[model samples]
Structure formats: C-alpha cells, structure tokens
Target: MIPDNEDRDDNKVYFFFTEKALEAESNGHAIYARVGRLCVNDVGGQRILVNKFSTFLKARLVCSVPGMNGIDTYFDELEDIFLLHTRDHKNPVIFGLFNTTSNIFRGHAICVYHMSSIRAAFNGPYAHKEGPEYHWSLYEGRVPYPRPGSCASKVNGGRYGTTKDYPDDAIRFARSHPLMYQPIKPAHKKPILVKTDGRYNLKQIAVDRVEAEDGQYDVLFIGTDNGIVLKVITIYNQETESMEEVILEELQIFKDPVPIISMEISSKRQQLYIGSASAVAQVRFHQCDMYGSACADCCLARDPYCAWDGISCSRYYPTGTHAKRRFRRQDVRHGNAAQQCFGQQFVGDALDKTEERLAYGIENNSTLLECTPRSLQAKVIWFVQKGRDGRKEEVKTDDRVVKMDLGLLLLRVRKMDAGTYFCQTVEHGFVHTVRKITLEVVDEERVEEMFHKDYEEDGPHKMPCPVQSSIPHGAKPWYKEFLQLIGYSNFQRVEEYCEKVWCTDKKRKKLKMSPSKWKYANPQEKKLRPKAEHYRLPRHTLDS
Candidate 1:
C-alpha cells in the first residue's frame, strides 16, 4: 500500500485486480485492475459507520503498453505487483507484471506505474451513461461540486466528508474512468522484460534489496511456469546511457516441469519458498556449488546469492576450518580436483556399513522397503537382487507391487523375495546409493522380531524421512511392451512365474493340469499343411 502524499492527511491506498462485471459481454473476459484506499484510523469502521467504510474509494486501473499510432496492446490479466519504496521518493512506485488473455498473442510484460498517477486518475472525473444497459463514458458537462472517489479531509469539508456522500455521477466516474490515459513505461520507456516463449510464462515476482560489491541493487527473483526461478537485475549503463537487464542465473527448483504458482523470499534467511500445483519447495537463494568449479566463473556471475570464499564458491563466506585453506580460482571449476568442497565425495559405500538387513514378511504378507533421495532434482531407481540369482533387476510398481511416497511396498512376499534391495538417486550423471535393505521372508514370529530389532537399531535420522521422489508409474503401453520384449527387463512385471520360470518346460508343465491330459507332439509327427484330405488336390498337382 502507498499513501497519497499530495494531501498529507489523506488515507493510504492499496491496488488489486478483478474481472469486470460486464466481462461476459466483451470479446474476452477482460480483467479490471483497481486501486482502493482506506483511512489509517479506520479500524472495524464501527458506530455510525457500522458495516461501512467512511473513506473508501476504488477506480479501474489501465496498465497497457502504448500502441503505435494509437493502437495499443492491452495485457488483460494482472499477474503480480510490487510496491518499491525508496529513500528519495515520498510515495512508493508500483511495479506490475501482466499477461494477455488471448492464446494467439501468448506473452508476458512488465509495467511500472507511479502512485501519483493513480491518485490523479481517481480525483479527475466521473463517467456518464446515455441510456440504460449501456457503456460508461467520461462526462462532457460541468463536473459535480465535490469530486468523486475523494476521501474525507478537514481541508475540503463536505456532506459527511467521505466517499459515501459522493453522488451517483461521481461514483460512476470513478468506476468508468478509473483507468489512466497514459501508459507508464520502464526505465527504457518500454517493458522492462517481455518473454514471448510459449513454453514457460512468468508467474510471480519478488524483489530483494541486495548490497553487492559495487553498490546496492534491487534484484528481481522471477518465478516461471517451468518450476524455475530466475535471478535478474537492471543495470544502468552510463556509457550507453541506457538501462540493461541482466540474468544472473536460471535455477531449477523442481525436477518435473510443473508451473510455479507462488514465491516468497526471506532476505534475512536467504531462502526462497516456492509453491506449485502439487507441492511446496524451499530453495537456497545461493547455491554456489552449482555455478561450477571456476573462480572466474563464480566471481563473474555477480550473484548476490553466492560469494567466492577464496577457497571455494560458497553460499556464505568460508570460515572456521575453511578459513585456513589456500585459495584458488579454478578449485570448483576444475571439478574440485582436490576433492575438498561439498559433493566432492559421493557418500555411497560408507552408507552400506550402516545398512539394515531384516526379515519383513511371511509367505504372503506385505512389507515396505524405505529409500529417500537427498535432492529433489534426482531420480530414484530401485534394484532387487533375489537369492542365488547373482543378478540385479530393476523393480517396477505393479498389482502386487506398490510404491509409497518414499519407498517400495511389496504386497505379498514369496520365497524368492529374499534378496538385497537397493535404492539409488541419479542426479547430474552421478549415482549415489541412498538406502539398501537385505530382505528375507521368514515365519511370522521371526518377521516381527526382526522388524522390531531393526527399528530399535535405526538412529534418529533414519525415521519417517520426507519422500523426495515422484516417479511416474503410467507410461505408454507400447513403450512398456518394447521394454519387456527386448529382455530390457529393467522395468517389467516381476511376477513369481515370470521371475522363476517364463519360457522353460516347467512353465508348460504348470499350464498342463494333470498327467493324463499331458500330450507331447513329436516334431516329425506335426503336420505343416491342413488335413491330407483337404490338401489332396494340391498334393496330386505337385506329384504330376
């Protein structure tokens, strides 16, 4: 909310957007952006003004790009807004992000508006209607006594001294001519940023005041439709005498290409909370490690979220044990050749020492094997190696097999279920084994005892961990068939029969019920043609 400073005693104002009431009759359901004001002292608006606001005024907001030769491009939907207050300015300026409603011109635009302009539009004029069920137009005749959408003040005392006493003519003007005639451009007199790529549109905008090495800068954190957040800043180029927009980084928050619906930044904590249709994710504003191993790369990035700590590119200034290490520019960029920084050593076999092996189920009982990934960007792969097979097979979720939020749940365990099961996370071409459980099918009593012992031995960090994987179960039928036909048995139906005997004589014997019904046809006895009587004419012709 920005206050109207021109009238020192006037109430502060807030801006929002909503669809027009008559939008159903328009070419498209155009949205109306509006600015509303409320008195600072009005709390609960009680007594004489019960259930009523004495000083409340709102007008439509028109934030469109100026067109060539009076033909303007209107962005119907207001996506997001920010009110930036500076030390030099009395009132905060409004920065709004907008998008078009039509699918044909799918694009996004950024518009900046001044608080004074909005106040003037509200105080200027009211709209008039020539006939019923008609559109509203600016009144041509003399304006009314007290202006419409004007708040009550001691300077201009009127009836009740509030917007409530404003006549229908004034109220209609506020409603009709709420839009400003001129479009507020960015620093370059154009949109600050316009993205025409159809793949991902901008959704949320968050600005943080950053104190970089050079000076203070307002960094824009823009969330997009592809679950990615972009760090951008506007730099004033003195030589060119123009404003240039620079993108610092493109950060991926979600593995799946889901749109980011909401974003909030905490400068104090240096963390960003992102909300999507299915889940909410927290991302550290600066992941210096992801910037790669070069010192030049790290410093040249000029990311307010990250800093070069001499020894390494880090989220924070390297201190404590890291302070004494000799600094190098290409440490991280050279793959951390010394293996000193984070992620340099993969925690693989070290985890196996603490792994748990337990008997979990009876001949026909359900059991769960837990595995969770360290990073959401990684994909989880489950591996099962039954006893004596000496071969590992990729596990797939199916009827008797189900995958829980963090782990695989085997509905019914057979004798062959005894095996070493593994869950590994694949990220950035690196595989790290997250969990390993050697499963064994045993009696009910042993199963219970083993599970109890396993739970007791597990440390605090291993219980009820958050599931970090979202593997898709349903794929194309032909794709699944192709995977199965090529003996590419990685993700296939792991039935007891299919695993033990699929193409052997044992399978045929199982299909043939009793010994009496079992008949073996010799290869010589098998006839290639139809019955000899039906093929007699063809046989006679061949013989002749």
Candidate 2:
C-alpha cells in the first residue's frame, strides 16, 4: 500500500491485493488479484455505506503471456508490488511481479502500470451481469447519466445522497467492470528479469537511487524464495532504444535458507532490511572502503560510496555522524586525483624555521638529527650547511656517521662535526629544507662535570646557562637525547622556507624522450618488400 500524498494530500491510499471473496466463492474456492483506493481522511461513516467503504471500488489485475490458443496462459498471481517514487517525487510508478496459475505454462512475468491510467479506468462505464451464474460483460447501453460508482454525495442536491443514492443497476454494473481493459507494459516491452528453474520465484522487490561519481542511477534489490537477495541495475541506451539489466551482486540474508517474505530499503541510511519467517537482517548497501588501498584502484571502481582524500581513501557514506559527507572536486574518479588535490600543497618554502636548535653533547655521546619527509615519494637530502669554502656539500655516511633509512643522521659527537646541518626534501624536483640544526659540542671537562652533577644530585641536573641568548637555560639540552630515542624526530619541527629555485633537472626529465617513442636498430618485424636482387628479375636477363 502507498499513499498518494502528492495528488491527494495524504488522504488517499492505493492498495494491491489478492483475496478469495466469501460470497462470490461460496460454492467452492477461487482467488483473484485486485487494486483499490481508499480515502483515509474519512472519519464518520456514511449512512448508506455504514462502516463499509463509501467510495469502495476494485479492479482486476491482468497479467498474462500471449499464446496461440489463448485458452489458459494467464498468470493472475500478483506476488508483490513496488511503488517507486521518481525524481519528481509527485509521480510514482507501480511494478508488479506475477506468477502463473496454470500447471502447463508455469512461469513468472513482471508488469508496469501508471496511476493515472488506473484512475481513468475507474471513471469509465462499469461491467454488468448479462446472464445467470454471475456472467459479467461490459454494459453497451448508456452509462445512466452521472454514472454509478461516483464518489459525489448527491446529484445536484437531490434527496438521495452518497453511494446510497446509487441505483441497484448502477451498483451491480460497477462491481462487474471493476477491471480496466488496457494494461501497461514494462519499459523494455518484456519482464525486466525472469526465473523459470522451477525451484524458486521472485517474491519481493525494493528500489534505491544511488548517487555515483557519474550521476544518479536506480538499483533494484529483488528477493527470492531461496533466501537470497539479488541486486541489479538497469542501464538505458537511447541510440538502441533498449535497456541493459546487470546483476551487480547476490547475498544470502538468512541463516537457515528460508524464503525471504518481505524486504524494505532505508535510502538515507543505505541499509536494506530482509525479513523471513523466523528472523530479520539488515545489510549495508555498499562497502566502498574495501575497494582497494591505492587511489587508482578506488577511483577506477567508480563506487558511489568511496572517495579518495589527499592522504588516504575514505568512505563517503559512512554510518552515524560521518554519514553526511560533502562532495569535493577530489572525489575518486578515472582522473588524476593527486593533481586535482594540489590546491592543498604548500607553496612557500616547506621549512620556515630560522632559529637553529642548539645542543650540548660529550665527545663520545651519540646524537641523531631528524629530517622527516612530508610526502611518501619525497627523498630526504642531507648536507653540511657550512664548509671551508662556505659552500653547501652533501653529507657522507660511514661507521662514525650513519644515515638511517628513516631520514635521520646519527653522529658520534665530534669536534669536526660541530657545525650547522641542513635537511631538505626533493620531491618531483621541488627542493625545500625540512629543518636546520646547529651542533655545538661542549668541552669534555664541562660534560664530565654535568654527568657528575646528575649522579650526585637528588634533583634534576642543572646545566650551565646556555650561551647568552633569548633561549631559556632550562631547555639547554633541547631534547636531543629524547629525539634520538624516538623515530618521530622528523615530525618535531613545523616550518616552511619562503623561497624558490628553478628545478632545471625536473623540467629536463619531463621533456626527455618517452620510452613509447624509442626506436630500435632491427626492423625485421615490419613488412618488407622483396630484396633488391630478387626483385631485379634475374639481373635484367628476362628483359634482355
């Protein structure tokens, strides 16, 4: 049942039903499918109707497959109906799944119908009994003016009112011609999907609109008798005037493999509820984060629930507070997400700190200088900021000086190593300093006194005040020992240098020859004409 809120202001309900009438089938038993309308706004019962539906009207549901004889190819069993609200929200389309009643042509068919067409049929002339044994036929005579089965209370304020005013002939006519003559066909002129294996049949269906990277698409979730749910998508092709139906996935919603009785969808939450005789289960519509770890993989999957943030892949429709995600230009697609997300890139120098970190270390004490690269692809480049020629030179590594794989320089504190050191990252040929450190090695006598002071004192060791500067004496050591112990030293400094340099090497590399355009010396793979000697017709002997 669905309410026609758009047209009737929530006062009307359209119902699809299959019932065995007690009076009509009193002799034996016969079942028929029907569609009817009810005014939910009706409160006090009318005098004639008296608790009965005052505007009650029903019509037959016609579902059939054409046959040569046209004898008994009817499939009157209306298993389920789906009321799909389109984008307009005002108009709703009805889809019915029907199964055969005859034993010979045991099959299923899907049909579509419009609300307006059904209403028009109700307004037309009704069917009437022409002979005994409930023989019903269309009334060829005049429709009796103002017609029977009209919902109006009275005809021009006459004495009779409501359905009670309707004459017996008109009421009986309406009861017989309840069904419309014309029936609607599916969009593809056939059943969207069918099952004839004789083991199971379609039981219920639900439709959901998915907002993908491309656009919105309607997906169908169909339930079957074998405790399975099949998800399908219908793609329309304008040029061929056809629709392509694809089965996206299938899931088993029940543990005991019981038939699925009912199914419903929560569009806003992206959840589908499947019900069986014993239990009910809820399943999420999409698991996008599982597409893959790489950005290209996530983008190429084209899932509606996945998006690639600059650093990692994230779920666009996560549950709870994270569900309301706003779309950005960098959402995953078949395009370059990394390039599209460069707006968040650092423009100025990545290293902004000018004040150098001062450290006091003994001759034999070990220390580590950290330079963490901001990007995974960036290469950390270390160099001595000062030398005899006052020019920057690449730092060399040996047993005394170790370069850790994590972009940290381990040094055995020495007098020669006491100078300003630089750490820069070279990513895509863009060079920027990560940080600068000044290693001021203290004399051995002062270091020994500091150690003695630590062992002998009950309180924290108080180092001699730092060389007269703006820095506090309490921070003289500057976390050098703690920084070396932990590998997160690269993240210690947050700075960016406001400078730029021409990346000639990067430009040259970009303009260099492409491997696809490479040429080889051998050309035997190409189609070659006959050798000059062979094509010469035996050295011109034939011509001579």
Candidate 3:
C-alpha cells in the first residue's frame, strides 16, 4: 500500500502486471502491460456488490519505440516491476521491465513511471462501450455525489462513513467502470532501455537511489536471462536535449546461461543478492580494486559507488561529518578524468609503471594481447613502440590481425613484433591508458639457448627444484639443469614445455613432488593435480 494521503481523498495500493487486452479483436493488440490502483481503506459495497472492492481502477502502461509509417514497436509483456519508495509515501518510482514475444521483432525494454502520472490516469475518464459492436470511448455519464473511488476522508463530507449507507449509484458506477481511458505513459514518453538482440530478455530488476555530488541518481541493476546483470543509470543530456542511458557495469552472475529468478538489495551491506535455479550470488556494489590503482582509472570508471580517495580507488562513503569527504573525487556524469583527477600528477615513467603487463609470443606462431576497458562505451586503441627505432605507431588491422572484445589477435607473430604495446581507451573526451604490454617474441634459437644453458657453478642461480626422481640410475633430467638458469618464476612454464617435447609413453616421466594444502580435496590427489585449490569458494557459489 502507498500514498500518505496529504491532499487526496484516499490512500492507494498500486498493481503492475500484464493481461489479455479487452479490445483484442478490434485493435489486434493481444496483451497489454497495465498499472492498477485501488483504495487501501476500502469497505465492501452495498447489497448488489458485497465483500468486493469498490474502487478498483486500471490503466494501460505503454512502452514502445517509434517506428516508421506512424507505427510503434510495442513491448506488451511485463516481465518484472520494481517500486522504489521514497520519503513521500504517495509518489514512488516505478520501474517496469518489459519484453515482446513477437517472432520477427524480439526485444526488451525498461520503462519508468511516476506515481503522480499514475494517479492522474486513475482520476481521468473511464473507457466505456455500449454494445459488442460499438468501439470503446470515454464515458459522458453523470458522476455520483462523492465520486465512485473516493474514500471517507474528513475533508470530503463525513456524512456516510460506511459502504452500506453510501449511494447505490456510486457503487454501481464503480462496479461497471474499472478501466480508465488515459493511458499512463513513461516519464520520458519512451523506453529508457531497449534491447533488440535476439539472444536474451531482461528477467528481473532492482534499483538503488544514490545521492551523488550533483543530485540523486537512480541506479538500475537489471538481470538478464543470459545470466548477466547490467548496472545502468539515466542522465539528461543538455547538449542534445534528450535523456541518455548509460551502462555503468556488466557483471556475469553465473557461468552458464541461467536465468535470474529473484533479486534483493541490502541497504546496510551495499550488496545485491542474485538467485538462479542452480546457484546464488552476493555481488558488491563497487569493485574498486579492479579499476586499477590510478586516479584516472577510478575517475574514468564513473561508478557512483567508487571514488579516488587520494590514495586508491575505493568505495565512496559520503561521510556526514564532512571533514573526510572533501578529499574524495568522483565524476559520475562526465567522467572527466583529467579535470577530476588533478590531485595526482603524472610525471613521466610512473604512468607506464603503474600498468605493467608483459606478454610473450613465439615466432611464426599466433599470440593474443588482451586489454579491456572498464567502461564498455570506451573505444580501445592499440599502439606499438618498436624496440629498434622506439617510434610509436598505431596497430592497423588486416587479415592476420583483428580486434576483438577480449583484445587484439596476432595470427602469426614474427620476431619484428617485439616492442612495447600500449592499450589506450577514450571515453567522454578523456584519453586514458588501460595498460602497457611489453611484447617479447622468442624464436627457436632463443628457446634452445634458454633451455640448453649449461648448469652454473654457483648455487645462488638455481631454482631449487624439489622433484624426487624414482629412476636413480638414469641421467639427471634436463629440467634440473634448465632450472639452474631459468629462475623460479618461469620454472613451471619451462617444465611443461620440456615435458611435452621430451617425454613419451614408454618413458612417461613421474616425479614425487611436495603435497599442496587444499580444502575439501585430498592431499595425495592434489600433489598430482595442476594446482591446489588454496582458497576454495563455497560449493554453490556462482560466477562474478
């Protein structure tokens, strides 16, 4: 139940759902997303209608995209609805998640409605029809004394306090006319979010009202049937004079394409609860550490929950005392990193030092370089500085090279590809470097030299391999000799390479290694496994 009833005659309880259209045959509209309202303090009607609601009113909820030829693509099926209550009990924000089942035009949309508009719709005219052959139109009949849906408030004449003593004409009018004429349109007169991709439809939604530096912004966490949740916000563009929808984050809650069936938000913990048939997940509002330890990355992310607190990207806690709040910087609307992140000065080498990612490629073999921006709206650009000339050049695409969502793909890497690759992204006129990749292409000669080096005389250079060989009579394995030169960091990779090239079925190598600690796993089995599950998650945990 909503409505505090400050200026109105009654408090109301709102309803949102989808049902078969009344004029389905005439208009060819199969279904309609609807919003209904009923008086909360309702008394049973008189003799003709006893123990029934006397003030039920329903209105059409339209969500559509304007198409050509004066026709619109309508999202008629409502999948989910979220009512966000504010301080005003009467006016709450209504978020409707809608989808269409049209075979040719598969789509999903998000529509927002306000309580005032809904109340106006209920207070407007009613849809009436005289006969089966007649079209439905606004009724021009006489209204009752106290109105059909009015409650017995103190201001509206306190004569008859009960339904039994009320006028029969008002009861009859309320029973017959339940449908309103004026359809309740969305706040923007269109859908705030529309997805026509045939892959998945939006299943559920939860919203959090955030009070930013400018004003309160509604952040939407919309769950999809494909196991992904999209964090979105709407902003009004002053330049274009239109409302723009911005996607703040996209988190996959499940590895498989499991539809999200239920969701709830925790106000005290700042957590979102997601549920599927097989798994459940507790997602945080902000993953500040993933945005990189830089002022530019934190600011460019534009996450309302995150801010640069002069040292690191962290959850922006708006303190009431106001002393600690001045140092935090966050720009959710513009994402103007250069302007907003002026506290940290980028000198010269520190920018590249912050994002150090080294990649190795083999000669005449394929290699992939990954670089992903925090925001999906940003444009990724790859640049390379050659090792010999040290001149920067843009990485142009061709048949051998292609840009994908993950990163850049090099079909056949050559020795000349050895350089320093930079991954930069531009979003909202703010150019920020995502990462710096140091590419080192190793050929057959380098590989042979690395693995075939002679064992040093000193003990300081060895990787201290603890592999206990059962074959005591055989020659010492090449890995121990190579381990003396290669260091501990690259031992496992080199070991795998040497084992693949040297071992066979007849002489399948077996080395008793140190047992690793694992949870819910056997130490004997974990010793032979690739790696131990050092930090095992809950068995029912879903994907991030």
* lDDT leader: 3
Across 1-544, the per-residue lDDT of candidate 3 in tens digits comes to 7764673545667788899875623656578888887777677677757888877778899888878997888898999999888878668888999999677878899888888888888788888867666667888888787677767665567676766667888888888888888899888678888888665778999999887765668889989888878888888775875777777767777779889998999867889999999888888876776666777777777777888777777887766446547667788888888788765753311333435555667777887787666667789899999867878899999998899776889988888887898888887787767778777676756556755453444244553333446435665664555444435676665555444334442332343322221111221232344532111111122344
Point out the worst 10-residue segment of candidate 1 by lDDT: 535-544
Task: Flag regions of model 3 displaced more than 4 Å.
Answer: 4-9, 24-26, 67-70, 130-132, 254-256, 278-280, 320-323, 346-350, 354-365, 412-420, 438-544
TM-score for each candidate, following the candidate numbering: 0.48, 0.48, 0.78
lDDT of 2 by residue, 159-200 (tens): 343455556565554544554433333454445555565756
Which residue window of length 10 is worst by lDDT in model 3? Answer: 532-541
Ranking by TM-score: 3, 1, 2
CA shift at 181, candidate 2, in angstroms?
Answer: 3.3
Q: Which parts of model 1 are misplaced by more than 4 Å?
A: 5-9, 21-32, 36-72, 85-90, 125-141, 155-188, 236-243, 293-295, 305-544
Better of 1 and 2 by lDDT: 1
Model 3: how far residue 8 lies from native, Å: 11
* Candidate 1 per-residue C-alpha lDDT over 233-290 given as tens digits, one digit per residue, 9 for 90 to 100: 6666667655556566566767677888988878779877889899888766665665
- Which one wins on TM-score? 3
